[model samples]
Structures are given as structure tokens and as C-alpha cells.
Target: MGLYDRYLALRVRTTDAAVPEHVALVITERDLLEQGAYDTLRDFFAWAFEYGATDVTVYVSVLDRAAAPTLARELEDLDAPREVAVRQPDDVERADAPITVGIGLGGRSEFTAAIRDLATAVDDGDLDPDDVDETAIEDRLVFPNDPDLVIKTGAERLSDFMIWQSVYSELYFTDVNWRDFRERDYLRAIREYQDRNRRFGE
Candidate 1:
């Protein structure tokens, strides 16, 4: 067996958990930028598309200095059909395929900052109560969407991954680092997710 297969075998044998039918992965731009692996992100997203991902949303926080527009532009330039999209807050367009790629403005920040920004805008008269019809300051910040499961591999801390969307998402953490993340490790995480009862605030 290949090394990855071996790891999968071990996990499956040891972990008596079930596998989830649908799965979504959230990767931080820090990891991608640090490794200079924009291609890796592209490949992973393409794979996810082929893997029957009903919906795929990739958020590029303007707040991240490492993932600057230069790098994003370079990566977007190399791709074939331009499956990747560069979108601002108001430019969201619906698509045909179940899988879609979108860019948003914010990441794992407490809505505290967002609230404060909106308040500042209101107080400074940049935005009036009547002027806030369709466009509002809150529209710029990215909020986490609740996923059925969230898996964080590598590193001990939460890494400010998903603050809002993961409120009820089942979290499965592993010491396995990102570089070493193999298919088996992912399968194991899925199995772990399947085992959860997920009462979901009942």
C-alpha cells in the first residue's frame, strides 16, 4: 500500500466512525501564501469541483497582507478556463454548476469590528439611515456560514479559521500537519464527523 493508503487503513481500522456524505474544506490564505502554493489551492478547488461539491465558496480577505492582489492576480492569470473569480462585495453573480467560486472581503473576525465600522460610518455621516437601502457597511464584511462539519488539521490553536459559521459546526481537530494531510486523514475526519449525534441546540 502507498503511504497515504496505509494511513487511511490505520485510521479506518482504529476509528469506528461513519463517513459524511458531503464535505467542505476551509483553508486559510496564510497557509497558501506562506507555502507559495497557489497552484495547490487551484488544484484542490478543481478536485473539489470534480468530487461533487454542491457548493464551494472561497473567501479572500482583503485584510490579509500575505495574500495580496499581486499574488492573487498571478494565480488567476495561470489558470485555464478562469474558473476562479475575483469578486467584490456587490459583484456576486449566480452560476449554473453546483460548484462556484467567489471572493469576499472579510474573514474570521468578531462582528465587533464590523459593528464598530458600521457605527463609525453612520456616526460620521458617511451613511445615513435612509441612505442604507440596498448597500450597507455590513455587506462588506464576510461572516461564516454554518457548515455541517469543520476539520482543522495541523497546529494546535483554532487559527482564527471560522468564527461565525462554525458556531454549531462540529469541530474535529488533528495534530497531523497540513503538509502531511493525506486522503486517509481526510477520510478519518469524515468518519469522525459521521459519528457525532449533532443535537444542534435542541
Candidate 2:
């Protein structure tokens, strides 16, 4: 490891701030089009796990729906450190791998679909309206785990990621583009998260 990277690792190891077990990353399709972007993503997964995150969620926002399939195939080809489960926009199945990648899956659409499923269950006498709480909604989401920290690269806008899950999660935004992201950048994010006093929606 580089001298600066070792120093950052030591800082994280010595800090009192709680390390986020589940970390989420939001990037755009355009960002992936850049050279060496996939390599950065693999490094990101390694860093997250090395820094104590057990689960990593990656959301790749898409402007053109047609590009989703191509993107999914490429993401599946990534040499990630952990098993990766890639879900497309229309998929309603739950993902339970250590790494979950959502390609062009809009958070609003996912939430709306979950609500629709609950309503259908109610009409079928399978569920009661009163029991349609947050858990009910979460049970149907593709990526249901609420991340402790969400990182958005190259942009500040959330772009509709994890609407139901991230209500209380701490968010970190960086101007650095995905292709240019490095291990040091990930460590910097960890350091920044350590400095925050989270209120958890208080």
C-alpha cells in the first residue's frame, strides 16, 4: 500500500465513528462509458469490504432503457471480489448477495411496484391494509437493505436512488468522476463519514 493509503487506513482503524456495514454507490451510465470505469468499480468493492462493509449496493442510473441490457452484461463481467447479483429495472425479485447491482432500476418505479403488489394482496384477502407498513414494502424491494452510507460520484443529485431505504442513511457526494476514482478516494469518503454526527432523521 502507498504511504498515504496506509495512513488513511490507520486513521479509519483508530477512529471511534461507527463503520458502515452496508454501503451504497450511485453512478450514471455515462460515467461507465468512460475508460477504466469498471476497474474502479472492482477496486471500490475491495475497499468497501476492507473498510468493514459487509454489503455493497451499486445503482447505475440509465437515461436510455435500451442500454440497460448491454450495461448489465458488462457489469456481470466485472471481476468483483464478492458474488454479484445484477438486477434489471423490471425485476421485482429480491437480491441477497454480498454485492447487488441495479442497472437502470429506478427507485420510484420499484417502490410503486411494491405498493401495487401489496394492494393486490389486500384485494386477494392475503394482506390487510393496516398491515401494509414499511416492512411489507421492504419485503418486495429488489435491494431492501438500508445502507449506512450512500456515495454518489460525479454528481450531487441522488437521481432517485433508494427512496424507501435511505431515509436515514448518511450520504456522501464527490465531484470526482468514476473513471478517476481510486483507493485514496474511497478512503477519503471513509474519513468524511467518520467526521459526521448522524441524526438518523431526528
Candidate 3:
């Protein structure tokens, strides 16, 4: 780790409570299996629990069932890991483990916005609302926005993790890798979020 990273770690450790509920982790198949990286995930869950997160979801795309067994086994070993469930967009509703929805996206954007747009069109009479069911319309809509702050680390650019939900979320990116993630870094991010003046179109 660099001196700056070490500095951030120190700051996070000294910070106060700032964790929010409803945490979602977006991980590619390559990051989990190919990268042989499960420790970062374990750490994230551990920290999320420590922060008092009631609901936590792990979002995955392009999954291989063969890899699921090993990952599930590892997750089963942890105390809070059992609370974490794997999901695809189609099966998000069936998720019983603390509402951990797996949002699947076959199109260009994440499903949430598309669903909202589609529903709005139906509501606006632009499309036939009778064709879609009430539950289906509700699923596509990303209402009750729970995301307040989203931290994208290791990569300077924002990945398509919570593209729809994070439309107005405070974004903080770091070059630090997942393995090096520490409590202090998390705290600093929260502190930064606290300091921001959110202007949601006035």
C-alpha cells in the first residue's frame, strides 16, 4: 500500500458511524472465481455487518453454477454470510435472505431505470397498461430510493454497479484495490459524503 492509502486507512479507523442500510455489491464472475478473490468479499460482508447493515445484496452477472457451490460453501462458513444470497434479476423477488435482489440486465442499461421508464410510459398512457401486471410494473420501477452514497474503489471510473439506483447518489471513487480496503477508508468516504451539499435540482 502507498503512503496515501495507509493515511486513508488511519483516517477511516478514527472516524465515526456512517454506514447505511441496503448495501449491494456488484462483482463480475471474473473477480470472484478467475481472480481467486473471496477474501475481499468476506471482508466486505464482515464490515457491512459491523456497520449495522440490516440488508445486504451481492449482485452478479454471467454466473457459472459450478463456481456457485464453492462460493456458497465459503459463505456458509461465515456467521453473517448466510444472510447474503446470490440472485439474478428475474429471481430477485424470490430472494428471501433479507431482500437481496439480483438485478439482471440483458439490455444496455440496468433494469431499474428501464423498468421505471416502461412503467412511466404505461402510466402516461403512452403504452397499454393493461398488458402488464401490477407486480411486474412495480418490479421495473426503482422507487423508495435507498441508495444515499455509493463508493466505487479500485477503479477511478464508475462501474455499472448501481447505475439506476445511484442516479442521485453521492459517488466516491478510489484507486485502491478491494483487498486493501480498510475501515478508515470507509469512514473517510462517509465523512466526505456528510460534507457534501446535495443539490437535487433544488
Name the best candidate (by lDDT): 2
RMSD in angstroms, candidate 2? 1.0
Compared with the true structure, what per-residue lDDT tens digits does model 2 show for residues 5-111?
89999999898888889999999999999988888899899999999999999999989989999999998999999999999878878999999999888889999
User: Which clashing pairs does model 3 show?
Assistant: 12-184, 13-184, 89-104
What global local distance difference test value does model 2 have?
0.91
Off by over 4 Å in 2: none
Each model's lDDT: 0.51, 0.91, 0.55
Report model 2's TM-score to 2 decimal places. 0.97
Residue range 2-118, candidate 1, lDDT tens digits: 877576556555665543323345454555555535555555455434333434444444454544556456545746323544433343332223222333333334344555667
- Top-TM-score candidate index: 2
Model 2 is weakest, by summed lDDT over 10 consecutive residues, at: 86-95
**Least lDDT summed over 10 consecutive residues: which range in candidate 3?**
99-108
lDDT of 2 at 7: 96
Question: If the candidates were sorted by their lDDT against the true structure, best first, what order would they fall in?
Answer: 2, 3, 1
